[model samples]
Target: MRAALAATGRVVRAETFRLLRKRRMYVLAALWWVVLPVLVLLLARVLQVTLTGSFVEGEAVSVKTLLQGLASPFGVARVGLVAPAYLSPSPYVIAVALLAAAGLGEPRTHRMWKSTLVAEPDRRAVLAGTFLTMQAFLGVLLAGAFVFGAAFGAIGTTFLPTAAEGAWGRLAGLYLLQWAHLATLLAFASLAIFVLRNVTLGVVTTFFLPPLVEGLYAVWRATAGFEPLNRFNALFQGLELQATLEAVPRWFLSNNLYLPARTSAAPLLDEVVGTLQAVGEEAGGGPGGAQIASLLGADLTLPHAGLVMAVYGAIFVTLLVVAFLRREVA
Candidate 1:
């Protein structure tokens, strides 16, 4: 058993190395890890200028003035956004799905099982080795993102606000969820790789299936109490707070998780659309910055979100292992 496990580890490691050796994979990984964040930060700064000006009237703001204002708010603002990305599961799904699918797509390159089969003839071992190695690589890639996000967050402090422990904790929790999300993607991709025997089909399945499943589950959940696949949505998705927030009357943008609400007096597009008529309420009133500050006065929430994601990882890892073990290598 020990020898088999050791050999599997070696095979998996080799698969990771094989992906790393490819120039295209290197580029995609770097773009996700390094390029995307920098661009996002730059864009965030730009958006801060544009949106704040649009929302706040007669504020006499230039881009420079807006940026200066943000320096103080940077930490808090980041707490709301960038910190989440560090911990968000969305990136991991994307990273693992694309890379692993692509890696499996070019099976001719790795010929991973060909040599191993000669020695052991255990197809399960070969499959396990490939899957385990890919999963580990996905994990490393995820950790790298967290580190980069946190580091960027620290730099953001230079312009934003100081680090808060609560924010850091949430970030950690979010990453945990992201790890689970990655595992699911890894499992799905590995299975798809084995069955489809082509990367594009696998990639498409990985990319499209989560949302499709979630969407179908949502339709079911609307009528039925709780849908089974509904739990998997966040694991695949980057946290989109705006979409989930339920606007409470002059109080909070409640996700029903009891975090403080953000205050921006702008009416949500949904509210504005006449498709859904409001029952005994005015359409245009929302909270202000003070309200947001009041709601999020403290970041005392434990990471239920991350914990949920961990469950996803655990479930899928088991499934993937079983599938890999049972599948025929040839």
Candidate 2:
């Protein structure tokens, strides 16, 4: 047991070092940490100027207002541990896909797996180590993004709203959900790259396939009047579940950040409310009806979506491991 633990630790350390050596990783970190935040702040500034024309030559803008303006761009909504803007699954998906494609695919492309196998021998351990390293790196990136958002909010705003009652508990759940969502995508990408032995193809498929499938499913639903297809979409599953769980609060916070303030009275909000009402009315009507109902709100039944994501992640990881173990690494 001691030896096994030691081996795993060594592999994890080695893999972490190897990934850090890659210039692309540095570039990605820079982009995410520095460039992205600056761009978001600039965009927020421009929007504020255009919308309110508040950037008078000598008028002083409160740091609080500036921070509030920054909130939308940085995905910080409300003063809670939950950042509604950062709740979307896209960033996590994109980051994991890119990392998996480059990290896993490059080994095959450069014929490095053989040497890696020879050094590690225990392929499972190596895979586990690499997977752990990837997760850690992703966690760091996510944390960095969160910290940057918080920093912006702190510096530009004098007042931070207290998190809503029970938000702390919900925040913990949100963190786990976000991690699971990212892990599922990462596993899928890993399997794709491992099986195809092409990073570009894996990346392309990871980025494109979900949306394409969802689009087709949407078309099918429109024509067939069936919503079952929605259940299979990871993006929709995550977002809808989030929406359902948070309900009106989530929608209100998100809309305030993303949409123009003038749209508060728009039909969109009414439509959303109506949808939620319809879902509530249809709940427990039938399996299909329940699913449809869940689709309408923040889907507090997030465990179902989490389960689906887990199954996908498990299947992909299992397949990757089995394939790697059987393949002759020459």
| TM-score to native of every candidate shown | 0.58, 0.67
Compare the candidates by TM-score and give the number of the best one: 2
lDDT of 1 by residue, 223-270 (tens): 542224355554433464323331221121112111211111112323
State, as a TM-score between 0 and 1, how close model 2 is to the true structure. 0.67
Compute the lDDT of residue 287 as modeled in candidate 2: 30
Q: Give the per-residue lDDT digits (tens) of candidate 2, residues 207-249.
A: 6676565555445544543335555455666666533532322
The parts of candidate 1 lying over 4 Å away from their true place are 47-90, 102-105, 108-112, 157-166, 217-330
How many angstroms is residue 233 displaced in model 2 relative to the true structure, after the best TM-score fit?
22
